[model samples]
Target: MQIALTGKLAKAMGVELEPVNDEQNPLFTWTANWTTVWDNRRAEDLLVLVNHATRFTVAVYQVKRKDLKGMPEMIKQAIANTLLYMNINPEIVEEYMSLCGDVTFTRNSNRKAAAWVTRAGLDTSVYIGHEYNGIAKMFRDTVGASINYGLVNYSGKFDDGFMPYEKMVTALTELTGKQAYKYRAFELMVTLDLDVYQAERRIIVPAGLEFTRLHEVLQSVFGWRNYHLYDFTFFDEKSERTTVLTEPLDEYWPGDEEIVLIEGRVLADFMPEHGTMVYTYDLGDNWEHEIELLRVIENYDQESPYLLEASGQTPPEDVGGVGGFVEFREIMLNPDHPDYETMKEWARFWSPELQDWEMRPRAIRV
Candidate 1:
């Protein structure tokens, strides 16, 4: 039935009405909520058998929901947990192998509906089932041995398993407690002197920064590359003659401007400096065991560089030689401008006193 008719059906059957239509309206208490077991599973992993087993568990549970909201959520969570314990935990590829498992009934005969868990952009929080299919019948122990046996024998039926969240979660779990699964990140900053049209790596000074811990923060802030690629750039740049105490952009100091940023500490501190155009806190690296990895990336990416001042001895020059240091003494920023870009990007920049690096956000992304 159409949405209007569905509401009318609910009203006519006295199905206990709630805001199931207009999002602003609160929903009634009769929604089916299926709780999905959430683990960051990417599209196309190898946990289909486990996922299928979880689906089978959902089918066999025979759980039914009166409301639409909570029912799917409950089923999703139950199934995910079951899949993890039943198939994923055992490390078997085919579903038939799990016919004999150390399975115990966390939920037996209490559920009466089916919950689908596919990465096809299927409903995430809940799946309001239209009908109970193959997986649904499994909850009731209704899937015969013939059908169960076919799953192990058939290859085409299991292709989607390679692309679902089930396998991703299982694989991630297997990879956990290892460096490959841990948080890995880096930052890149590029500062441009508007007067010279020459850009280099630089970070924000303390006066323009505001963070309790500068090292720990990772953020994305407004930045300047080619002005057309990002937001607007300052036409009025600060001349070298001005006192650095004045805001960098007093006369349009390109490196001294700020940009808008999505809020967060991990992504906030390393956000692009407005005029400087810095990009930091980059996760997922392409190379291992190398300092100034970003500089290498900048050399190859053919993308505009973000301002990264502390990159200690500006990003290695592309002309087969390390560029000479661009000293703060020559610039208006200050003689004491911290080489934060270098320290954050490469540990070699850390001095004896500044070991175990940790910093926080001190500038606005905008």
Candidate 2:
């Protein structure tokens, strides 16, 4: 990897340069806007992103760390590789690359443009949770779409029939609302068995508040004095016993027992963006005992003690209870925000990992 700029335009702006080359990016540098280059990466040749921005690295190819002798070419290589990774036609990528070397251009915009940073939510900060949800909810209820707020560099709001960003503020103004974000305890889901049994129950509680007010809430919800000992059953759609509510693993069966798997719906109140599910299983004998257990499981979301360990890991279908692994594999769109194409590239890199690692959604007192 190397960099070699034929003109003095990039240097005059104190713009740092680098040569990138690797399997994904077979070029020297990535084609991006100037602001994007500055915001997403360090100005140094071996530019790297820190914090949440690092999640966006997935969009780039591995570039060989080298010198600036062929910096432009290397940057071009990285840009080309990035285009290819993005599934753009080679001809289209080439066209964009050619623009970078246009000798006729002399203006700052053309020279300064490094990569795209979205200005769509410029003045708005999109809150994905309930922290700023009051405005969003008002906007959604009034306009029937998600509204944005507190954008760092935006003033104009967008409006679409379905979640248009522009008109959200107007709608919010009409509704009279204000919103803020407050961090609470992280809920943990300690799932031990598939929610297929009658008495089969899944408990959700906060990570650390297991013995506080939340503990009492859990006790009251299921009407149980204690849930230390109970029996439950797991059943399939046909109402047949697939697995007993004994343990996460099938200890009674031989090596090749198949679990009767079941599907459940997940629901969240204000923070619907958080993952959730409602599973129904057979109560069996513990059905009476588990009523209280269910209360604790449902109430102590912030104090629950469950963490998703190995996703995409499932036991063979022939292995009874071990086969109830549910992998919610949905491909979410990773689109760029207006001109902030830099964030788009970053999202493509981080989305997959974030989707893979998730705790159960928080349970509100809806």
Candidate 3:
């Protein structure tokens, strides 16, 4: 695995980085800079390490420039801790790994990590360069608290998303266990349970994915713009209890049942206990869906969500509810009808080619 270092850090440590290659397993990257802190002028240096696959900041260190000798050990310890947290044995990781990649000085390499650290409240506290900046203390305490208080609360694009702590716990557990079973994926049958039409899709996603990620995949498969609120409802027959997982909201609506945010909850949490669940999107329109767990795929290696099959086209958003969609479909089918032109024009808001609608499975990248 390649350990990417900043140009300045490599120069200071007198280390050379090899050229980039297609076959290298990039594990993590490091960036450091000697900069002024508060009233001090270039008194301390900062170091940031980011995981390559998850794009999550593994650790951050702030110390005097002269203490650079210990950075390598600290980085190694951080990597080991990260692997342990992910349930991946460190020995397995070290078996096929090499040190140092090309010095990454590009902005795109570390921008996401920098933004994540800032949003996590790690860069707020300030101190003199020669004194304690409290970054290490703040990061540990905040991360511990945040893990329980909605850890993977991502309100952004799928590619920019981070690997949630809860998700990482079980992702690599099978690797370290005695069982010969490999990582698994879930084959789901997501159907739009509307009276007007029969729209359904078959998708496969990593079992370790959070409900939020699943929500994104659903949006992509259904051709929705995701401009409204949504929730998942699961019912247990034996206990006769109903659980609702919704997006993190500023103010939750009044209800008797317990409401759980989908942020930190992985799909594996409810897959074994519940075979099916209902997803309701756009409360105003009430687009209800039935998601059934078809089966668990053993030894699955696909990292991203994949579309296995699709049936029928998803209706345009805000085409009213079922009744409205039924009427719209009738108008669309009868091209010679008076409202055909108007209906086609309105549907273009969702897709440019409403007349020739087809499901493109490759478009579902989430």
Candidate 4:
């Protein structure tokens, strides 16, 4: 039974599970057997299994009654408490409830049960002698599904052991028959003064990503700590006007310049294939980065931005600008300079091997 369940889950997750080998139990079959001890003894059964290897869990339960309608408040509270105990986020619980509303339950002599789980959080579970094939099938069909965009970045902190909200929404998109925008992959060449410095990178991201998210990705790719203000400027030939997208800093500078907030605008709203723009970081330093839309990738399956290729290390933060970097480079190269040791220490802090200026193509994961 466990083997069958695992196979179903693997199919949903687009992955394969290999058979386990044991020296002492070499003849053991691949089939999984549910221990009798795990069977429910009480009127209600609630089983929660956490698998840290996959960073997810499996929750299965069976109520005492056959009908789901007019379920007692006590039973609902019990389920809610169990979910809280499992550290599942409230947002995920809400999404599950929303999806559950679409399912039509059929009650029969056999007990009725429902299971909700997904890859990267919940997996799969089966109840004995239960008429929940519909619910189980729904869960299995949407496993391993990718979403257009993530509600929040997964930074390996405060993990709620649930699949991302976007993934859940995507999985339910087809079932709900809701119209959703298809995300397109974009390949861009970002250069910091290609005419002189020649620092550049190749990045691929989804068109659905917000400009703010793109800003964060640029900081990661350029090795910037994001300590200063930045803005994106582009010339719209159709509109025949220069558009500037920047953070809202009304308190700092209440100028007449029309500055569009980057929070809600998506990349595809303004950037098209072969489009070009300029990104200025650190107003004081006036560091300008040239951004060119190289290509548009159709039917790509990735959800997050990736650093495809990078060349020419980024300048150290707060190093006065391009001119400052040039001066610092000269001092570092000349061992006889008065501040050579100090500059060398600073350079080593940013790049341990002093490879800050090395122009080499490399693959980096963000």
Candidate 5:
């Protein structure tokens, strides 16, 4: 990337000039500090010119004090010059300005702008700090442009400046929000306590995900075949309240004062940060799982539940809970016992590799 100064504005700002190519350098990253090349020049204010190398596009950013104070005429002139330079239709811009009308720009506002620009079939997106959110919003709300935050990353905080370019690019590539865009996502740590079996699984899912969907995700994570009923009971330590959100069963009901249907409720509604929840599956076998909300991540973009980490092998379903599973495992390990061959055969039939029972933390995506 190279920085170059151009035009009369550059000379006025005491910016050092760089050689200009016949055609703009195809892969040169340059910053041109030409303060308000448009009519309203302020000695105190700063302007920047950014040229995107690969995209071969140029954009101007005007940075000024939060409050313009008494620069209405300057602002009007800058707006006119920008409109002319960008070659955007005046009628469309007018409609957008009228619709947004003095909106503040935030980090999300930048994201929305990026989304909009992407949708508009434009290859580039720009960031202008001087109250440009209104214009960005106009592009967003009107044309449904997908703002590309990748172009320029601003922290939107008064203290923190723009995020480092590398970090910004990394953030843009990763899953940073819920798939639905309406609900905030959460990173939960669900662990199954097999008691004497000493087996557990660490799983994560979105907060807005239904408990029923979570049930299926857990089934996959633990290698369960989904052959039993499950229920989730959330406990808030601070408030000392228990909320039972579970599937409705015809055969039995716990008769609790507040038994909510799990089908409708989301995890975020009841699961407090660092709070605990008990998830019991298969009433007959009583496979219990302990769930804790580790953290709530706003604007996370993980669409499906996935296994983050795991330890030990999951007990086979219909193994008569923890005690039965422990006993079965012991029997299979004892080769000298009379029933060892029979139990081994059964275990091997289900698991295949019975000898490789090492409890090590393994990371899995699904």
Candidate 6:
């Protein structure tokens, strides 16, 4: 692996730069921005590393001027953290480095690191003064946001709409025969726990998705407006209890049980074992969904999760739970009934797709 460092970092490290051939080996470049803080008592530097092939900001680190001496170990740890953030096994760090070749120090020739580091610095500037989340979390969030927005959303800067994340994953999969951390795709069966209606949605999502993004995928596939609170309950086999993950809110929970925040938690962390997890939405309406992981799809090509199949129309929001849904369905079945037109109009208000009075479910990508 070739790691190119800026002249300042090279000078700080007391390393002599040697000219090398531009081979096909994987290359990464490092750049930094220094700033003084706390009344100029200490100097802070933002170290940014960019993958030359993918042009992805692979790792980011914040450190003091004195800590630069241990940059060799810091770079390794940062790469491991970035790989973990991408849902890739960090254990392959050494193997990946070996596959790329020996570590060679060189001065950047293409001048690509400056642009990438500048973009990273601008994208992460808002988190510089954040009270709770430090630079590590900020880097994780930046990486996730970039992947979701650029790769999954197909909004990359390339003219041909190339995705850097996909390219990197494909390269790694080819290099390593075992797909240990290629982001396994899980096929999930989500069924609405209703006594009458048979609403079920089959979805395929990458295991690396965060709970918050998974919530959005559910909302899109089920045609929900995402207007209410929701929580995911997963059974912990070891603890013999259920754990709840939800968005942090200023409300009181009944027990002292630790509630996990869904902000930075990925689905792989609390994957439900052969059993089912409950996704409860809208505390008032109490729409409980039974989510089951059916199987893992091998070699899934999609960047984002989608609805593989759907059946039965979902109930409208604020329909007063299952009883109200039953009553509404009964009225909708009988046009001669007095409240038929009223209920139909109200249902149409919630879902404009009910124009033909028929529920049509189809496959869709979220």
Q: Rank the candidates by TM-score, best first.
A: 6, 3, 4, 5, 2, 1
lDDT of each: 0.25, 0.28, 0.58, 0.50, 0.47, 0.63
lDDT of 6 by residue, 1-366 (tens): 566776666666676666755755554433443332223344445566667666555534355567767766666666656655555544454567556544557776665565655565554443343322342423232332243124311355545565555666666666665464544678899998667766788887777777876887788777788778999988877778768887777784745385777777876776644356888899899999899998876655544466667766778888898888888777877889999888888778554223332333332322
Candidate 4, residue 332: the lDDT equals 68
Error of 1 at 360 (Å): 4.6
Report the C-alpha lDDT of model 1 over 1-366, residue by residue, as the tens digit.
Answer: 001112222332343433323331111111122222223522211111123222231222333333333432333344444333222322322232232222211111112211222221133212223222223222322111111112221245655433223333344344342111111223434333322224333333222122211221112222111111112122224543211111122344455434322222222233232222222221121001111223212112111112233222222211111122233212222324476454344433323221122222232211
**What's the lDDT for candidate 5?**
0.47
38 Cα displacement, candidate 1 (Å): 22
> Which residue runs of candidate 3 sit more than 4 Å off their true CA positions?
1-182, 250-257, 349-364
lDDT winner between candidates 1 and 4: 4
lDDT of 5 by residue, 46-124 (tens): 3332323322123323344442332333333343343322223334334323432332211111233233223222322
Worst 10 residues of 4 by lDDT: 105-114
Which of the numbered candidates is closest to the native, going by highest lDDT? 6
After TM-score superposition, the amount by which residue 25's alpha carbon in candidate 4 deviates from its true location, in angstroms, is 27
Q: Which stretches of candidate 1 lie over 4 Å from their true place?
A: 1-176, 180-187, 196-219, 223-366
Candidate 2, residue 59: Cα displacement in angstroms equals: 8.6
Model 3's alpha-carbon lDDT is 0.58
Each model's total of backbone clashes: 85, 89, 2, 1, 18, 1
Off by over 4 Å in 4: 1-182, 194-196, 251-257, 352-366
**Displacement of the residue 324 alpha carbon in candidate 4, Å:** 0.4
Q: Give the RMSD in angstroms, all C-alphas superposed, for model 6.
A: 7.5
- In candidate 4 the C-alpha lDDT for residue 22 amounts to 32
Q: What is candidate 2's local distance difference test score?
A: 0.28
